[model samples]
Target chain A: MTAALMDGTAVARRSLDDTRTRVSAYRETTGRTPRLATVLVGDDPASHTYVRMKVNRCRQVGIDSLRRDLPAESTTAQVVATVDELVADESVDGILVQHPMPGHIDERAVFDAISRGKDVDGVTANAFLDMANGHEETFASCTPAGIVALLDAYDVPLSGKHVVVIGRSSILGKPAALMLLGRDATVTICHSKTRGLAQFVSEADIVVAAVGRPELIRGEWIKPGAVVIDAGYNEGNVGDVAFGPAAERARLITPVPGGVGPMTIAMLLAQTVSAAEQRES
Target chain B: MTAALMDGTAVARRSLDDTRTRVSAYRETTGRTPRLATVLVGDDPASHTYVRMKVNRCRQVGIDSLRRDLPAESTTAQVVATVDELVADESVDGILVQHPMPGHIDERAVFDAISRGKDVDGVTANAFLDMANGHEETFASCTPAGIVALLDAYDVPLSGKHVVVIGRSSILGKPAALMLLGRDATVTICHSKTRGLAQFVSEADIVVAAVGRPELIRGEWIKPGAVVIDAGYNEGNVGDVAFGPAAERARLITPVPGGVGPMTIAMLLAQTVSAAEQRES
Candidate 1:
């Protein structure tokens, strides 16, 4: 039997609808739209496109957007200062710094500078720790959170599953493993240094590939009935798992372009609304 | 041939001796002994004994000790304030707060209040995140760090090995998994919520049991010829794994009291010296 697809576009549309309703209520009560600050550094074509999409989505959901464009030559201190200003601004309910900010700039230092209250992207170490520790007060990294939401929406029970996460990146693999663990799954995290990757994948009841290596995980490597969630968006929108073969073996699979990518922006919007509500409360 | 036993007592003695020599050098250079503040709340007899043992160990290593005893009636805020004072004190090189401090107290909040620099025990969320993210700048929890040292001392190569960690406690299982991952081991973290725990253990090349459930892991659960590191210390000093059967089958195994217990204090002393050195630098 062919694997059932996890439709990210559909899920995102539903989430955006919910966000629009929440924004309307928030505006009615406060006489102002919820505001989110989007900071984009450097002119990386992909980064620009992603930021533009997010800003446009904000307007669609009735959230006011604040844009900060910084040059590629910006110093770490200057970026941090700008983020600090946004943190202190009363009108800004959420803040997101688009990724791949310049090789010389310390991205973590800048991400940490964003106030936890306004960390809509949940890139800070504190936010990750809170998610790992199962603390109630935490905003998870958007992509991982979105993946979990997709899994739940599809009625895939995580409890007792052997989930082998192939990759350990901060935004995807690491947080996804923690999120699965939170749901009672027996989680194994594999990365560049991991040995016998195929053996681990073959034994897994669920496989999540976020290694960003296109077709690195072969279909034959997957357990026949395991669920597959491919979050990798590499060159040509390819995923870490070899989709055609993996799809044949997986009981459920999420296609690259239609899967985790759309859900990420959906979570960002949902979290922005949540942040706004929390601020008002 | 029987497996060689990992003797924690012997290793701890050597470690303590090394710490003593370092402490002497620090005292001669700085004209002050390294000091660690030990905080205890309520009158849990076991906790009291543990703190006293730690204090005596500090004295043995030429490290000064400061004791703070609070009544069981202390509120979470009160405990946090006490920890905050220690965090701000330049005289305190490290702070060790005895665990299971009253049900009413929010232990996590108190742990977070300890300055990350002075959190030699590595209980703070910041430290855990650092460990998880493979960042070099955070102190590892004492027991987990001690386990890594034990493996290194024994010349066990973790790279490319399947290391199954049985437990999810922030102090032991989680940090141990992170440490093994850092060393290139394919790490799996299991806990009470995990299904088929024995199956996971049976496949591991290295197994670490820190669940604190007395003999919960059966002997047959271990993979034949696997290295077993028992970090559990339950009532009567029993470990999580059934030692008798596991020892018979495993290639190397650590005894209950003589396994990971003594190493905990040894790591604490080593970290305290490191903390003193850092402060000097």
Candidate 2:
């Protein structure tokens, strides 16, 4: 039986619509639009594309956006200084620093420089700590937050369900696992060092593929009728899961391009608006 | 087959000896002893006993100790004010605010008040964030740090091993799971809300029982030859595991009173001394 699509596009649309309303209300009440400041380093075409998409979404929701573009050879101090400027800017409601800055730049130092209050993209260590402690008022990393939103949108019951997340990146897999655990799902985190990965996959009631390896998770490894959320976007629109075969075996599945991607931007816009409201009120 | 004991008491002794050397060396070089300040908010007998033990250990290692005991009726602001004093005190190298402060007190606010550099107990959001990001220079929560020390002392091969952790506490279970994951272990976190707990436990190469319930992990649930670390300290000197029965099946196991308890104190001392040295240098 072919599995039903989770249709993240539809869910993200609804979420963005809600964000638009919130943004309009805030603007009308305060006579000032909420603003998001983005820091993008280097000329990585893909990174630029991602930032542009976020900016466009901000505009669509009536939130103002500003960009800080730095050279590829910029030092860690430079990136951090830029973030500090955003932190001190009274008009900026939220701050987003695009990931994978450069090899020479200390990413953690730059991330930690973002003030916790303005950390809309939730890359700061404080954000991770707050999220781990199950603080609802704090923002979560966009991709993981989006994954949870998709799961909730589909009415999946996470309590006591076994979820195996195949990746351990701090931003993606780790936070995703923690968020699922918060929802009372028994969470397992698997990585490249994990032995017998297929064995672990077979036991999961829900599988989250975020490893960024194209088709790394074989469809046959998925437990029959298990729910699948593919958070990977690799070359040529491929996902970590072999979607065709996975869709045939899964009860519910999220497609790559339209699934996690759109939801991520939607969450970012919604969080930015929330950050503004929180600060204003 | 009878399982070998992990002997945390012996491991802690060796660790404490190293701390003593470092403490003495620092005292000799700087003409000042390292110091740890303990902030005990209430008069809970158990908490007092725990803090007293820590203070005594500090004396044994040649580190100075100070205490701030607040009333049980103290407000969150009072406790936070006390912590804020320790944070600003240049003489205090490390600060520890005992857990389970009166329910009325805001524990997180108290923890956040301790400066990151002086948070030897590692309860601050900064410490958790640093540990989550695999920052070794940052202090980890004492119990989780001790658990890793025990694993290393036994020469347990964690890489690629499946470790099932039976709790999700910020200090004990969650950090322990993340530390093991940093060491390349595939980690599963099961909690009170978990279903089929036995199935998860039976598959583990290493089992960490951090749930406070006595004998919650049964002998029958243990896989043959799996290493078990029970971090639970419950009523009547019993552990989370049924040791008598579990030891009969496990390859290596830590007993209740002599196991995780001492290692925790040892880690606290080591980290306190490290903080002092870092500050002095």
Candidate 3:
């Protein structure tokens, strides 16, 4: 492979190490562990796995995990009330509601209910706006932050780069574009409505694929020597970009399993520790 | 002059006519005129003209105008406090603080202080998030809304189009991208940090120039037959795009003076009426 591999696992491990030191210092000073409340709605196997991964990572990083698993039939009001209770709980420093909630539940309302200070997941509108406006408070969404960290670790400076982000969903595409803009990179977000997807990607110095469509971005569409960060973890562990051809052209490329996925949990842990520090302070 | 003029004045006039009817109905039902508070800090000649134009449009549309002129020495807290009072005032339907506040003032804090319900100018972070997320909200920024209205009037469908927005300012570029995304247009925001500005523009089906830098975007940069909306009204009335060359290539182009300027005030009035109606409802 001519393209240098952007190892998300290695970066995440470093981040976890840093977070561990911070957690230790925080615990020594405050005599308490930083706590994260994870709310999982429904029994989707993937969702359960993701939550378990996060909770286990939190334990390894010396943070407390409070898990709330709701049944599939949980009402919007019940979910919101549970989130609100977490918002008010003094013991919980951060709250994260795993994605793909039951079809009936109002996800926006639930995300909005989490206190902005304790919104470690950074899914709330407030956090999105804060990130968009260059005033990130408390936390940033893990995937977006991880993408930026990956770029930084690879020494891919975003300043003056044309960053074409393929997606507009709040969690990944939107926050990723905002973070890129914050770094002074000119960002363009392409979604389903985008007429010419390949054309935009072809011109990008940095391309971020978070659209969740497997291999939607063709390898030939990538600009020569551009840095490509694939945030897409699609079915069968695939990514948005067709890696085989893209890696041949890209100067630096992130692989599916070892790229964005690991960094996400790392950022979550870092933010959780930061939240704890804020509470203790 | 082969390029068809995007007559912002004519379009704005139509919008005002619609807004007038809406205002009449709102006044008839509410027994009160739609109130828009205009807060101007310092004596910027251009800012003065913009505010006067808006106030005049308010009178023409049968909406009430609340003008608050502060000195150049006004502190950030003072401006924020004034906005806070307006937010609390039930009589005020919308509050607009003219941009480019004195160098010392923290403008973001002042804008955020305006209650989201009364944020007709759509400067608040909360209002932006609301617009981006498709949540029903009070209003959008006048210029961005005007851009949408202009495109809609011209039968420009945003869905599935590559929209290259060349700016990242809160009121213009950022909000414009968000609004376009809300419309399902794949939006890419480019600014100083973008490496290949011309390449991005050339790939765009619709190019929106909101960057304040005069003639920053060259005519050759435009894609042939693209719809060009120049929101940039910079020094000496120059636009961000090189008008002459861009006009030759563009299928539709909005001129500097007669384009986005007039439409901005029109949308402000329209949203002001909507805010009033919302209050009454």
Candidate 4:
């Protein structure tokens, strides 16, 4: 491959290490560790695994985690009440809700209930607007924040570049585009209804494929010398981009398994500590 | 001019008439007039004029107006306190806050304070998320909402259409792009940093120019048979697009003085009555 692999796994590790140091220092000064309250509303095995990993990482980094597991049949009111309790909890520095809740429950209402002060996952509307409007004290949504952290760590300049983001999910694609726009990149958001999607992708200096469909963006669609971030992780460890062919055209490309995945937890922990700092001040 | 002119003045009048009917029906059934609270911070003459026009529009539509004009020296805390009072008042169905608050004031803080139920202007984070996510009930920001209303009124199809929106202001360009995306359009947001802005503009089926730079989008760059919405109202009645040349190429174009300008207040009133309808239900 002519392109260099963007080492997201290594970058996420360094970020976690820095966060560990900050957590240690914060605990030393404040006489308490930053705590994250994780609320899981369903028994989805994937969510269970993800939450366990996050909680374990928190423990390793000198942060405390409180796990709240609700049944799959739990009502929307029940989930919201649980989050509201966490919001009122003085000891909780942040709250993370494992998404894809039961379809019967109102997920958006629950996401809306997470307070801005404790929204480490950055799923709330308040946090989204703050980040989009370029407020200094904003907390970013985890995956989008991780994407940016990776881009910055790799010395990819955003200002004046053409960045095309494919997908429009609330937590990932939409917020990622907003955050990119805040940093001064010209951002275009394409979805299922878009005409000439390949032509739009080929013109981009950076392409962020967050659409969950596997290998939707072909190698020929990628602009040569472009930076590629495959934000999708479908079955069989595949990303939205055909990595082998895309890598040949891309100057820098992030692999699916090791890339955007690890950065989400890293950002969650870091933002949690940052939230604690803000609370202390 | 070969292009069909999209008349915003007539469209806004129709919208106001619809809102007027709703307000009158609401009053007849409930025995109380719907009310809108307009909060104007600082003594900027332009803001004073805009708010006056809005209150007058409210009067014309049989809605009562509560005007809170704070002095230029008002603190952010003070402004927020005023909004909180309005939020608690059951008689006030909607609240509108004039923009460009004094440099010393934290405008976002005040915006966050306005309750979602009464955020008629849709400046709050919660309202932005609702509209962006395609939720059923939403109060869109006035100008962005106005743009969509104009398009729908003129029977412009958004599905599978390529829409290039120039400018990325938090309340205008970005929100307009999101609203279009919610309607299943392929929306691209280009800003000052966008390279080859003309090239991007030329590829779209629908072009929304909101850059506020007069005549920045040249006529030759406009694709033939495209729908153009010139949202910029700069000095001397000029728009962002070179209107004369663009009009020759476009299938439909909104004029500067009578176009996207008048729809703002109309949307404000319509959403205010909408808030009242929800409250009564």
Model 4 Cα RMSD, 1 decimal = 1.7
Descending-lDDT candidate ranking: 4, 2, 1, 3
Q: Estimate the Cα RMSD of every predicted model relative to the unseen true structure.
A: 1.7, 1.8, 2.8, 1.7
The reply for model 2, stretches above 4 Å from the true place, is: A71-78, B73-75
Flag clash pairs in model 4: none
By DockQ, rank the candidates, best first: 2, 4, 1, 3
Which scores greater on TM-score, model 2 or model 3? 2
User: Taking the tens digit of each residue's C-alpha lDDT, what string does model 2 give over A1-281?
Assistant: 48899898999999999999999899899999999999999999989999999999888888999999999999999999998889899999999999888899999889889887788888877688878878876789999999999999999999999999999998899999999998999999999999999999999999999999999999989889899999998999999999988888899998888888889999999889989999987
List iRMS for all predictions. Answer: 1.4, 0.9, 1.7, 1.0
lDDT for residue A49 in candidate 1, whole number 0-100: 98
TM-score of every model versus the real structure: 0.96, 0.96, 0.90, 0.96
lDDT: worst 10-residue window of model 3 chain B: B129-138
Candidate 4 colliding pairs, count: 0
User: Residue B204 deviation, candidate 3, in Å?
Assistant: 3.3
Q: Please list the residue runs of candidate 4 whose C-alpha ends up more than 4 Å from where it truly belongs after superposition.
A: none
Q: Give the C-alpha miss distance for residue A271 in model 4, angstroms.
A: 1.4
Better of 2 and 4 by TM-score: 4
| Candidate 1: stretches off by over 4 Å | none
Please state the CAPRI-style docking class of candidate 3: medium
lDDT of 1 by residue, A145-190 (tens): 9999999989999998899999887678888998888888999999
1 or 2, which is superior by DockQ? 2
Clashes of 1: 0
